[model samples]
Target: MSGLADQGMLDLGPESLEYRMIGPRPDQAPTLVMLHEGLGCVGMWGDFPDRLAAATGCGVFVYSRKGYGKSSKATLPRPLHYMHDEARESLPRLLDAIGFQRGILVGHSDGASIAAIYAGSHQDHRVRGLVLIAPHFICEDVTAESIAQAHDAYDNGDLRARLQKYHADVDNAFRGWADVWLGNDFRQWDISEELAYIRVPILIVQGEDDQYGTVRQIEIAQEECYCPVDVALLPGVKHNPAREAPEVTLRHVSDFVTRILQGHEAAASAA
Candidate 1:
C-alpha cells in the first residue's frame, strides 16, 4: 500500500491526470488498469487497488480523469458525448503514454461503461479481458432517481463534504455526472451495441441491492456480448461493491485476472 501510494502523476499535455502504480512491474506481468466512478478520483479508490495488486500479483494503475482529483479543471456543461470522448480519445492516449502492452480493464460505474465502450470500439489486442463493477448498459428510471437523490444529498446533506475529500472541484465532479444523467437527452444513452463487438472475456460484479442500476444491466451484457461473461451478485451490497464487499469482490476479480494471464502465457509459449 505504501509503494502504491508513492507513485507519481502523469501529465497528458492538456490535462495532467494523477495516477498510482501498484504491485509488480509493468514488464513482468499483465497490468490491471482501474477506472474510477463518475464522482470518483484516484484518492477516492483508497486501498482497493493495493488489495487487488496483492491478490493478483499484477501491476495496477489507477488514475483520476480530467476535472477530478488533482487533474485540470474541465470545461463547464460537459457534452452528451463526454464518456464517448473519453473512450475514443483520452483513454487510448493514456494507455499509449503508459506503454500498456497487455492488460485488463477493471472499471466501476461510469468507468465500467467507458471500459465497455473502449473494448467494443477498439480492437486493441493488448486488452485481454474486462472486469465491470456496477456497470450500466442503458439509462434506467432508477438511475435518474438515485442521481436526483444524490443531487439533493449534495445540496442539503453531507455527500458533497465526503466527496470533496477526493475531488479538487467537487461540484464539477458531481454536476458533470449528475447533469448528464438527469438530462432528458441522456435517456437515450445506451451502450448495448458496444457489447456485441467486445471479443475478450468479461466478468460483471453487481450488488443485488444497488440503487443506481439493476440486474437488467447484467442481463443486457449477457444477451448482447458474444464473449464469455461471468457474474457475481452480492446480496447485502449496494452501489459500491468494492467497498461494501471487498473480500468477495477481490477474490472474483483476482481469479478472473489470473486465469486470463495464465491463458495468455500458455498461448504465447505454444506459439
Candidate 2:
C-alpha cells in the first residue's frame, strides 16, 4: 500500500510533530483527525488512516505526539496529566496549523482519552463528533495491570523489537508512557466528568475481551454525556479494534462519519 501522499513535520516551538494527510482533495471533506495509542506513532497506524479516508470520503489527518515516532524527543517522567496537556494545549495548535475547518476526532486507547478531553474542554465547534476506541474515562485496576504486563513484554518479550520499527527513540516512547501509567498518582486519573461536557455525537467502540478497560468506560460515557452515543462491542475482538476487526470497525466508523456529515449539510440547508 502507498503511504500518505502529503506528510511532513511541524515545528511547534519547543517540539516538532510529524503528520500525514490523506484522501482526494482533503480540503473538501471533514477531516478525521486520528490520535494513536499510548506507545503509537504515525508509522504504527499503517494503512488504517488511508482506509478510513477511502471509506468515509473524508480527509484523514494523523500525527505523532512529541517523543513518539520521528517527532522530537520528550523529557522523561511524563506528567500524570500528559493526556490533559495534549488535549488542552497541543491539539488546538495542531488543528490551527493544519487549517482544519471541519473535523471528527478518531482516537484509540490513550488517544481516545485525549479526544474526549479535547471535546469536553475546548468545545471546538469545528469538531462535529468523536470516535473513541477503547477509551479510558477512569483509570482501572485492569489498566494498571495491563501496563505492568506491557512493561514485562518490553523487557522479556518481542514487543520492544516490534515497537522499535515505528518509534525513533523506542525507550523514550515506552518508558514515557509506562512510567506515567504505572505511577501511583496516575491511578486516580479520570476523565468521566469531562465526558459530561462533550456536546457532539460520539461513537464508542470496544472489544469484549479488551484487557485494559471494561464496558464500564462505555457506560460512563452513556450515563454522563447528554449528546447521542453509539456503541459497538465486538464479540471476540480485543483492544485494537481497527487492527483486530478492521472490516467491522471501518463499517461502523464510516457510517457514523457519513451520518455526521449529512446532518451538518442538512443543518446548513435549513439555515
- Listing every candidate in turn, what is its Cα RMSD in Å to the true structure after a full C-alpha superposition? 2.2, 2.5
Query: Model 1: which residue pairs collide?
Result: none
lDDT of 1 at 54: 90
lDDT of 1 by residue, 143-258 (tens): 99999999999999999999998888889888888898999999999999999999999999999999999999999999999999999999999999999999999999999999
Tell me model 2's lDDT, rounded to 2 decimals: 0.91
> Mind sharing the TM-score for model 2?
0.96
Summarize candidate 2's per-residue lDDT along 7-83 as a digit string, tens digits: 88977788899988887433566899999999999988888899999988888999999999999998998999999
TM-score of each: 0.97, 0.96
Model 1 residue runs over 4 Å out of place are: 1-6
